[model samples]
Target: MEVLGRDRGSVMSVAASGISATSFASINAAGKVTLWDVRLQHKDCMSVTTDINMLSGAEATDLLLAADMHVAVALAGGAIIAYDLRQQGVLSVYNHTCDNEAFLAGTHPPAEQTTLIADENGAIMPFDLKQCRPTAHLSDRFFGTSTTISATSFGALSNICCGLGFIRPEGEKPLLCAMGMDGSGALYTDPQLTPSGFSLLQESDLVEASGKVLNPPLPISASFLEGYVAIGRANGMYSIAVPVANSTLFEVLAAPGHACNGLSVLEWTRGDRPRLLTCSVCGVVSLWDVMPLVLETPEGDEVIDEDLPSLDVAESVRDAVGQQVSVNCGAVIGDNLLVVGDAMGFITSCLLV
Candidate 1:
């Protein structure tokens, strides 16, 4: 994808979603956010003239996709700002500690009018999106490192070293799964978020491994399923059906050496199975054989389920775009389409077919 921005700085974050049959929003690194109509076939996307200088000497590190594609930018100076794309309004610019020591690491709860932001201080601050003010903040006893969604369910993962995946059922309060990031990949069931006993994603009646723990294998990305959770780990990609029954939760479909630094998972099969697209640091791109994931207990993890049928590889789409660059962030646009942002400041879009 070709990105046009007024700021000379590289794009820190980008989000694109089908707003309608004709319009989409593309926010760039310079913080110059714009909406485009591919149907009009215009050379440049429609620009929303703003008096507020978003990219003017502003340093934003990340962007979140919120309701109506509301763009929230995490500033380098440990503050957060949410902007509405459709309407020309500044939703809120969060005011917190101004100390240069603390940085805004990440933000979550993208859909809610209120969202949570992870700070360098290892705290998750819940902010009201409408007011752009902080309501409450909580600490997870660890640094706010990385977060992701489960393709099947609305659940999400907050992986702090050995971490917790938060799941809230309809009309029910959120539940926390005490998972470890030990190099070994699996979902563990610990009723409590504190350090305690937990169960791993295994098949035996004695599924919980006592001394064995989860070690951070590689960079991990997550997606949800109807009742299960799929994780894209660094060594390979695995899926775990939560609420462990007699079945194996973690299935290592792809093995080690498959760099999953930049992995993107989405609601695939028209909401049936979860689709997985991964771009590695080495510049290799691969697709997983995940169809609406269906796993049975005791049968062990199978590669070809009714949902996940096969693995596909489209070797380094980044390489095809001329010279290869180190990729850090990427997002899925509709189906069979991907846009990647690299350290070199290149935003390349590709048809995944």
Candidate 2:
């Protein structure tokens, strides 16, 4: 396996480009976005950096793969920016001025043209990429759902989206899926019913299990499996289920795990069953297979580390690519090819057996 590496800043997130499978992008805490081409030995193809001071802990960024090779980044400065990948630079640094809170998360499904940008306080705004501005929010239409309530009223993990996806509602467009603090996931979006935009679809109001409070959903990836988002349960359990959905689609029952710092969906291994991986601080990776996971998909898919090996990541990385640092985020190229960003601002791509 050929392991190749490159250093940028410190990547906070990395995902495959919606436009190209061999291409991906990574963003650092300081709002530096670096584009990489896996075909070029994982070399840095292009990059854009904001003027934020890296140590100030302000003006942070989260990414959404917008349409037409454009990446949307949410900033703590209450503004959203769009970068045109084809031009190898930013198209709109201030695409939209949002609410007064930090924009925490964003998601744009491949089928949709609008991107849902959520704030730290949970209020979500739909930005029409074609129009380049914030569209009507679901709350403006007076829709009532657990997700909207969580966002407005601040209900634990409900508003701070770790991941975003959609469910195929019986409408022209699918319902937007978001998590509720409890297991009662919520879905929104109905064209005929609510012409203005969306409505309260449904909330999965689940009770506490065994009297044990369920951990809030952590960082998530919507690309691992169709119709599902892999969540790192705050309890360190890895789950391959739609976030806050009524049912737990899949969870690997196993020993308790380290607090998952990150979770990325990697179905790159040549097989029918795609895999979900979780990494803790310094990049401790654990893998799970879904074919063995059942249909009713049990709960407590522990996102633990004991089941997997947390070998010294820095040393392992040094041996693999000669650069030793904690892994920040990752992206997969082809079947068996792995690419990751490290604490030292390095991006590495290699074939992992």
Candidate 3:
């Protein structure tokens, strides 16, 4: 394991390109984004600074690799900037009028050109890369005409929308999962942009509500792994079946004791079995064997088996710096290298055992 130190500020976000895993992007608390080439001994290949005055007290929230050698940054002020590595300056910047802070930004997996940005109000907007503008607001498109309007709208309804992920099931259209600030979540499938309609799935509809107001699990991050949506929450980690039907609630997974702040799903094959790499706020990194259990009922519906086998934590690594810093984000680069960003302004690269 190798630890890299940064003196600028806390590393807020990290993203690795699908086209070239050796290249990765990271944003710091000071709104400085840097692209690094891990193959070149983690050298800073490029760097840029966003408008700090326009941030309005908000930090850089998310970073993503939109295309080959292209990086997109989502600011807390709802500004999305696309940067090309070959270019000297930013390629383009799209500004959206968001009442709340932006939380996450990503591109649709199937259509890599379509960019999606999620905010604190639970609003998800789809942006066209070519046009450099938002295509539609997902909440308005999905449930604008419903009688129970507010319930369908994620706008400041709960704490905030913390995480978002796209799942592509075999022989089916892509599905989008939005994890609310609290434990509540929702799913959208077969989304249409023209008419703006989709099949919706809500957590309230699947699980019986417990009216207790104690400390509910707050999802901090999420990802699609091994045909399931893995959610990293304050209490523990949980996984729900993708393309969620009416039967499955999030199944809890035994994880680190502290809050799970970030997660990265790497495709790994261990004797035909799938696995994943998970990291937590307390700087606990673990490897798990993924085995999803699904049973076909007589009613011609699929349901997750109650006695699903628990994921085994095959390996674990604690804090490399030993300063008790939170791992804000992480990504897997190359074959077996794991790079992570911490709240203490340190980027560490680990060679998996």
Candidate 4:
């Protein structure tokens, strides 16, 4: 859990509240989840906080917020719980007893109403918010195991050294992404749709991208936007790629010596371009101008063909930053506000600039 303070109260994960600019949620190493309102509060992040304990009684590994303000908490024992922030009560409790390792869960920005949870061993469980539980129609190996579906180079990879996300481009259906430490990632797409979201998995195709760059081969984080997915590395660099199933292409965004533990993307407006917000192991927050790396034309509709030849590319980087503190994970409240927490159990907030 990256317990720098060797305690359960140490922050393990943080999630942004898309509904509010100054509000967010997080879970500590001790499995305690808290709602945060830092609008005009202290920089320490403790300016205003409310602890929400669901009685899972274990360390929570990761968390994310839904548009309805439902906070999804992924715990260590394979059980994931969701809470309704509006009522400050439990929404449902789900148990995945297959893998004992800490699980990771996330929300796709394009489809924030939906969430996906994956175990270190590589089983993905999609949460059907309508049913208030993992989908019952899908088989256990429906998506195939991440380690074997389309994988190679086992010796150099750690199954838990992973990241998962999904992207919904302007005119395309949403696509789910699962990544492992070997630098190989797979994409699963289902054209059919449902009210609860992509529930029918009649048959899915696995697109494997061999394009990889793992500096230290350690655990990493993922954040997605439009058609691109950024993979944060252990040695302080991130790889931006098309995320198509082919051999794939890569654009490395470097932050020398600054181990990246977290990443978030915010799309641009008419006056400015898109940006990638990154938080590091040492609690430093930085911004990378991302418009140039994207394949989209200025019109923002047409994109480069995903069937492009495999190649590694580098682009000129324009970056910005803010004050530093000891950080474990964080969430972007709105366009510019940032809220983060560390293993010492201290919550903090800062501006991207």
Give me the candidate number with maximum lDDT.
Answer: 3
lDDT of 2 by residue, 331-352 (tens): 5554445666676766665554
Off by over 4 Å in 1: 1-8, 16-30, 34-59, 67-77, 84-91, 97-112, 136-216, 235-270, 291-309, 313-315
Please, what is the whole-model Cα lDDT of each candidate in the order they appear?
0.43, 0.47, 0.55, 0.48
True-structure RMSD, every candidate = 9.0, 8.1, 6.8, 10.6
lDDT of 4: 0.48
| Order of the predicted models by lDDT, top scorer first | 3, 4, 2, 1
- For candidate 2, the TM-score is 0.63
- What tens-digit string does per-residue lDDT give for candidate 3 at 201-319? 34543344675443345555665643466565554544444444522333433344323443432223223454556676666666554455432222234444354344444323344
Cα displacement (Å) at residue 56, model 3: 5.0
lDDT (10s digit) by residue, model 4, range 1-353: 11112223777777766566666677777555666666443322321222334344456667666645455444545556666655665666666654433233232242334345566665565555544566434322222222121221111113653566555556655555666654554555531221121110111211225534334433366666666766676656555555333233244333332334433222111124446666676655556665563543333233343422222211111121132335666665666655556666766555554
Candidate 1 lDDT over 1-353, as tens digits, reads 34322222354454545333233343444454455444454513543333234423345555554535454433444456666656655556655663111112212333345444444332334445567666543233222322332211121233332222443334433333334333222232221233223333334322336754433343344444334454545444444434434122444243332554534322222223345566665456666655434433343455443344356656664556555566555555555555555555555554555
lDDT of 3 at 177: 63
**TM-score of each model, paired residue for residue:** 0.60, 0.63, 0.72, 0.64
Residue pairs in clash, model 4: 8-30, 44-347, 45-347
Worst 10 residues of 1 by lDDT: 99-108
Write the number of the candidate with greater lDDT, choosing between 1 and 2.
2
